[model samples]
Target: MNDNIKSFLSVLALVAVGASATLWWHDMMELRWESRRTMSEAARKDRMLAATRLLQQNGRVVNSVGSLGELIVPKVGGGTMILSGASGTALPGQAEEMLDWVRRGNTLIAEPRSLTSAEKAALAALDPSSEENDDEIEDEEEEVEEPKPAAAPASAQGKDEDKPKDDEDEEEDEEEDHTPPEPPARSYFTAVASDNKDPLTDRFGARVRRDAKACECRTEPAEEDKDKPEAIAAARRERDKTVSRLILPGKSYPLELDGGKMELVGLPNAVAPLWSDDDGGAVRVYREGKGQVVLVTNDYFSNYMLDERDHAQLLLALTELTPGRHVTIVRNLNVLPWYKALWRNYSLFLISLAGGVALMFWAAVRRFGPIIPAPKAERRSLLEHIDASGAWLWKADGGRQVLLEAAREDTLALIRRRAPALFRLPETQLWATLARDCSLPKADVSEALQQDAASHVTRFTRQIRTLQELRNHYER
Candidate 1:
């Protein structure tokens, strides 16, 4: 082949390879774009963020407070307050205050707090069986006490019959008056959908209900079923089926509620059922004074569940009932951070504390008068040097003997200067001469001159003192 033909073939091959690479890159990009589109965005931290936004979108002023304590009630035209994670039993005093606020023409939407152990025990004590037994006994006694009447004259018989009838009516009235009042109904959340028709549910064109089963389903298996795998599997299957989806008119949504059941007893004012479950009423309403209180059995307005079924619709309908356009949602109760609470409730105290600390730091760093000159550095005194040297020598091993020998040598040298003849004498004679010259005892002079180890501080101190005196005497 010619050179031009070969070059043209090479150029054509390069073009083909470039097109293939470009197509491959475009395919990978498309796959990545599809995957990214399928992935969900990051979840919000606040559980009620969606609900809050929903209220705002409906032209209502929504405010989210941390706790019930921080909730600010309007002075006029009371508005609606939604207690998301709060309950009446959690804070009795605060709950009562909120109720009083409600009585002044406001609406409070809250769930009831879970019953305590003592409360549960008290409820258990009021058993229906016991009440039924008492009623049966009373009925038997009344039957046994029936009395037969004797025949009387026509004129007196009529009056007698009318009098007995009057007496019987009065007795019946007394018995009715003496009867004990019925206990309040205990309501719980259930997986079964609510079939009741109410204003809240009617707004969404469907009934609202929690899909999860009652909390009691989470308990351990019974003793009889402990060893049976089949029994356990059946129980698990039962629990798994508790979750249900809400079938609306056109669409269905999963119910994702997270709350326990609550007892509706001992609540102030008369409670009217709004929604019912298999066990009891799941939602109730009552009036305090001019306003009303709506007690929900579960948290259906949480962030995760707000968009499910008719939860958001239900919330909107509730807020619309209030006189004003403002809505407050209390997310928690008594959950403020310590520092934030201190700053909010005790700002004066915190300000005073900060001022005091700042003053102390200023006093420490700032000069009270004109800047003072730095103290002049000076050499240590001769006595200080001597004391330091002596301390070091005393701490050394066999230091006491060395100290005595040095002192003795100095004394002997001084004596030699005073009397050179003393050096020729023997050690004992020199000690006696030194003792006489220094006016010290002969034994002390001899002990001080000897190279004996000092057993303790007292002996060492005495020997040092004697030698010092002899050296001074010889110098004199």
Candidate 2:
């Protein structure tokens, strides 16, 4: 089966491989922390360790979960991110605008999946047990119940007396406004195509890397976690279309022409925009003058080594070469040129690439060679016949006649226009000379000068027919 139809089978195999890789990589990318709480100290340490490992590798990796203080510390400690999560240092401040950091240049390289077993186990250990919450239960036991029959009925009037008149008056109005309402957020967003058609994408290309980052939003809970349900809700398997665009500063990325707009802020040099199909995750970046984001419908970047998933390696490789270059990857990585791959045993791809080059050469043959189509005995249409006849006549400066009668009429017209003294000679002899000299019938010549068709009966069907008739009638 492997050898029988290698080329045909290659097409099927390659297509299946591409689809499988796309889908598999997406699922691998779907591996994201589901927790909304801040990362537990351990998870943070794990992230730091991972970052430290990358730093130790003396190269780099794009940490999508790059929002932790632990992770950012490496960059701060000589590892530099395009943006920070810490306040005042260009990170989204830990205060109310935490998500705003994501608006800046940040891609959160987070832990895979929600709370790790270690984190959950640690949380379980640290959680207040029933015994630990005993004080709270006892405190609840002393609840201020409805005027109960525990002789507390005797205290009803006293309780009413305890209610202060000023306090009651303070609760009078629900309509009283204490603070101003916050401004409504802009609802529209633009989608910049990853096709690199926009001018602002000039900085992005394959091979560019940035020690840039994302909002340090933690997945583990603090004492309380509010983003949990929302996190689970995010996993509701629905397609999210609210993706922000990548653009330069001050350039308005308009989602709708009515001017509902967004600004392209800071983006990591490593985190260039790539078109991933159906990835539902988001990577938000915000800078002082620009804010750009690329959300995923599915995870296209895999967590494994490049050897494991070529597509992910391509993502990394693409970002590396992506700087200031216009790259169009026309083929998939069904195989690579690495030294250890068994698939490289077959040189069919090389053969195919060579085939493509041969095709190009074949295509070029037309541009350099003669342009006229090879002649064949195909029937010509009437319109084509007229054009061909005109072209033939143009190439040769001969008779204007299409038939013998036209030649006769043309001679008569010329004679009429000249009206030389020759036309004043004997009419029959003049006609005979015209017939002999110009290959027009004597009868046809007279017919042409006459106002009516019935004057002379000979008709010219072809040039030769007129010439023959004229020759037979003339003495010469």
Candidate 3:
């Protein structure tokens, strides 16, 4: 190849290397972003999806990655609806609309992070104190039991024999009047709490905290609940089973579906204590109007959980209990599916990026104008270089090192050019001779060069200037 061709090839090689480096760096960053997208997508699909098949069984399923209000409107026909991951943070008038849906006999199951202000306000109409007042009234009625008037004086016992039937009737009426009245029905929301003193919670009921225990498929009802209605008893049984299945499977077995652990949302006491571990109440239900609201503290119905012990049976029973055939699963309206993995839908971005890279590559291979000779490094005077170095060292807070080095260099140079015989002398003797020639005290010269330079800007400047003066005097 000709000399001109050789030169062009060298330039071309350099350009290729630079472009390759740029491409490599970009690829590395893209790989990291791609990895993160994969992880999050896997989490959403595997952890959050509750079924092997998507809402495909048993009912007219309306599945949406949107809020309850957006997916189902007001007076939407009654059905079994589940809103999982519900933070209770609604958009606009959604909360009111939901409450209306419940009033119309639709069961709304909500999993909230805690007692939301919106829920508290809506359910506040049901007072918990009314029950206590009713109990007090019942106690007073028991105290007023009519006692048969002290038996009439013994002497008159035989005189009233004919009127005995009338007295018996009167006693019967008094006994009936003493009977305690039936207690009034009360409804309120409660949760599991160690200290149930918050007025709001107290106004409702102290939250129950159940302890953790090994998973059990079935637990006998509390003694008090054994006499409850059959339907209520069955509901409680299923609820407990479901709560046990939701408990995080510990080290012995991992739920294959790794939906992240469910956070502790407030346990709403809409239902009775149907399910409880030693730690606290796990599930509850509350009746509002003709419908009921079920609250679960964690994500017990996740796909992995659904496969755990007794979970499938509990879910089936729950579905059968619903009044309608339509089952709605509501995910948070705020979590946008597309936003979670932007890189997965990057066709347009990649196209634009590729075009930009191609354009730059083409430009690199083609010269824009006549190639000017490459500039050579301009040589500078030694003193100019030294001055530049000193300025840099000063800016970097290395003034002490620069000043000491400069003083030593001056002493050596002076010894070489003006006092050749002193070049063979020891360091101390050399410094002493330089000090004598410069009329600086030997101690001062030694201190400036051997000791540390001052850190203060003014002091450092003065010391360096003094040293420089001594060097100049010797150079002259």
Candidate 4:
């Protein structure tokens, strides 16, 4: 092969082998855990499909389980909802479509973390602000409210005894009346996104701060009530509820519904506060044409949280928000990740890979290898090797043995070619059949075929040549 082509082929082979190894390793890891869980399987607690079953029983879920663009194209109708958990990270191309779906009145319940830049931009446009215009309008409105004249000082107001306060008392009264306003409470949240002028964030008043590490929350029974028997029985009943025995991630906080009313079931978290004291995370509802956009800081109503606290109640409430609600839960994967595809059908992938490598090898060798002229014959004549070996054997005193073996092989070959059925007979019967077929005397035929019995090379050669002549004459 040519150097360049050979080098390319070598590199290609190395890359294919490396890629195959990587896919094998990934497949092993996937098998090490479990098969990828579908949304319908309820037993997959780790992957959280329990919530899917709950939704299936309660609501009308759409068949929008593919890419995001599929659902957004027709602009999902109002009263229909799209549900997503933390796994529903939108692919890059899906951003615009998702924005349209939400803006067109479809409810999208997703983690703030999954919002793409395009989706965020669409969110920001939901409630566009005019800070400069608002400021100018406020400045214009304030000009009409002129301050009323202050009361006259005590010295000038001798006629009114009730207004006879000293200058020191008047200053003290002004100080008490004009209490300084409390500064705006510090935001315990960081922007879910990096947009400084993000209108959606401003409207919501807060978003989940990504910097806060997730804390594990284990639910335990509340303390017993000793004073009242009724209270103690109630406490015991409350402690036996399913929510008290589960372990859940505390990163999800309750969303306060103001513009929209919130529906929840089950008792509130009685343990230490799960969220920062200052970070009463925000929720905002924006009206877009006939539809509304409800944004929340966290996707707490998900499968992972369904069994913990009121998450199942929260999800049920979402679907039951309006009767006849159609909900579509978007379980997202990457936009056709190649490795995932390969791992999914590894046998086919391996076969294709091997075929490709073989083709590449063939092409490389064909293009790059030196060309040689074709030989005269495909195979040398049969007698050439026999003659060569026979000469050596004769010099080594094994010529008679070679002659005997050759004579026997020649006789078997002739009998196999003609009167083939007789070849399977005993030696004596085969000899008689051969003699009868060749129209020769039995004694002469026997003497000719037994030429191998001669011990000397001269006798053997003479007998072999005689038998050959006799066979040639009989065949003619």
Backbone clash count for every predicted candidate, in the order shown: 0, 49, 22, 2
Order by TM-score, highest first: 1, 4, 3, 2
Show model 1 residue runs off by greater than 4 Å. 1-43, 73-77, 88-93, 128-280, 357-365, 368-476
Arranged by lDDT with the best first, the candidates are 1, 3, 4, 2
Candidate 4's TM-score reads 0.31
> Relative to the true structure, how large is the alpha-carbon lDDT of every model?
0.62, 0.36, 0.54, 0.49
For candidate 2, which ten residues in a row score worst on lDDT? 254-263
Residue-wise lDDT of candidate 4 within 342-398, one digit each (tens)? 654486878889999999998888667577878777676889988887778766666
Higher-lDDT candidate of 2 and 4: 4
Q: Provide the lowest-lDDT 10-residue window in model 3.
A: 254-263
lDDT of 1 by residue, 320-410 (tens): 6667888888886556677776777789988899999999989887766688899999999999998898888889987767777787788
- List CA RMSD, all candidates: 27.4, 34.1, 36.6, 30.7
lDDT of 3: 0.54
Clashing pairs in 1: none
Q: Which regions of candidate 3 deviate over 4 angstroms?
A: 1-43, 46-48, 52-55, 59-62, 75-77, 115-280, 333-476
> For every model shown, what is its TM-score relative to the native structure?
0.41, 0.18, 0.31, 0.31
